[model samples]
Target: MTPFFASAASFVDPLDEVSAQMHDVTSKPLRDIVVAGERLVAVGDNGLIIYSDDHGQTWLQAAVPVSTDLNAVFFSDPLKGWAVGHGAAILHSTDGGKSWVRQLDGRTLEALFVDYFEHRSGLDTERAQSYLSALLSMTRPGPGQFFMGVWFDKAGTNGYAVGPFGLILGTQDGGKTWQPGNTSIDNDDLLHLTGVRQIEGALYITGERGRVWHLDQSSKRFVMGEVGYDGTLFGITGRDSTLLAYGLRGHVFRSIDAGRSWASVSNDFAAGITAGTAVDGSGLVLVSQAAQVAISRDEGTTFELLDVPRPTLYTGVVSMTGGQLAMVGLNGVTTLQIQ
Candidate 1:
């Protein structure tokens, strides 16, 4: 038997490849979907971004500068948006997801961490050393880093993205530059931050081991909040003061006082919930990894599971025109007309 060895020359960064080539990806796996004004944009593996102006009726692939597997996409406004994915990649699009340009990647992220930690070492040697060690472990090369969630403030001025090993980044000047936000949060164990959402003018983040953090404007830091469940939370969703955090094994908790307290929402499905979205008027929906959809009409007080047409592992969900719902997951994009 002959053994083969891996070499640096054989490795290629996904960001170096262009994603302009297109095929029929309607049946392909898509991770997330968002509505940008009247158009709907969906992103998934291999840096694929497809937009549909006529509601999921037709799709056109966007010009993506990278071929990495994008995990999340967010549009602060109709024309400005960002996408984050594997390799700690961040891509920006100015024209409503028609095209994308790389803003940050694992290499840039590594440099940023090194520079930030080196500067921080002077102020707090012990803390900086610990953080520097963690950062160094992730920067060992390849596509080991992943950004799971991305969100922008309503005004489109401030933006944030989160990922594994407590990686968080903030950008005040849109996507022009990014800064480390790990110091702002109290993540002692370096848990993976899987999801982030802005609720009631405040930002909240969910992560592994039942960790939930709320951004305190006065202190300019993310303060940890109490939650009963200890499973990994994949996504957070709600409107106004009501919020829902869902994750492994279909576990969900509802927060009425902006995450100060959480109460369990009754769920029957056993599949892990991957994403959720709030309806326009007064409702919310959560999607599971097994393609199960749960609808809560009473602001997450209760839920009713709906049978999907196909059983594909879903990753994200979004409300669309006329009370419709569009889900993205293992099978590209699917539309749901809720009655």
Candidate 2:
């Protein structure tokens, strides 16, 4: 019999290279940031994952198993977390952000998706065929697609990951297995699903063409929840009944009914709002790619401009203890003592 180590080294994907251990990781270009209890966790290009226990004062690199460009990171709780990235990679961590093991990658995800849909019934012919074609095409020599966002419940037993072309996957057994939920979604045009988050008591999925898909409790399917905008929504944020849909060109819409309906609560900034975090359900802070900050104290009903001090192509932000925030993007991590 072949040795265990020898068998494992039989094949490898180029993008599956492990992340490098580097000094001063804060100088790296990070893509997403999240607050994990008292520590702050961040992920970025080339499968980089780092954590800071002293609230972004200094950083420690984690042992990441892939070199893919991680686009988003989410923590269900302080100790359980997950990160998604290019190549359809999904990574899980049980000890906060200290380390990660590859849970799903393109190779495994391709087979899982194809098999799930092939056996699924009652799905439209076109959607099923579309998914199969994409899967086949992406199964080529490289990481063909990305899973942009990931989220899990507090119990860490349920979660979903979303990406372009209406792609969404859910796992009930804590990501031990995932099912393709894209076909069940009412996205006829195959709109790219950019973000997914549970606002209040409802699960909301955002995507291109100003579309919002809400999980129907009875039907267990995603149905359209229109917000009446024509641009792409990058993400959704809120706590309680209040929700905010962030889109291109600094456009933000507010929903007080768990995303059932929205009203124009635009922030008159010209740059794209990339990331935001709620301040204990009472307020929100948004960051733009053009180094701008918008703060709202009245549950996203109105907003006021704040300062970012340094210009960075901001992509993610999280609320920390006290009146402070941690942001990550092209310029790595920056902590602001928001007042």
Task: List per-prediction Cα lDDT, in the order shown.
Answer: 0.85, 0.83
> Once model 1 is optimally superposed onto the true structure by TM-score, how far is the C-alpha of residue 28 displaced, in angstroms?
1.1
> What TM-score does prediction 1 earn?
0.93
TM-score of 2: 0.89
- Error at 203, model 1, angstroms: 0.8
Candidate 2 segments exceeding 4 Å error: 1-14, 120-142
- Write model 1 residue lDDT over 1-339, tens digit each, in one string: 433445556666677988757678777789999999999999999989999998888899999999999999999889999999998899999999999999888877777777777784354878887877875675342257889999998677788999988888888888788877878889867788998887667788999988789989899899998579878988788887788988999899988888899998888767999999988874899999877998988889888988777668999888987888889889788888887
lDDT of 2: 0.83
**Best candidate per lDDT, number?**
1
The alpha-carbon deviation from the true structure for residue 250 of candidate 2, after best TM-score superposition, in angstroms, is 1.2
Writing each residue's lDDT as its tens digit, candidate 2 over 8-50 gives: 8886664668998877799789999988888899999888999
Q: Would you give me the overall lDDT of model 1?
A: 0.85
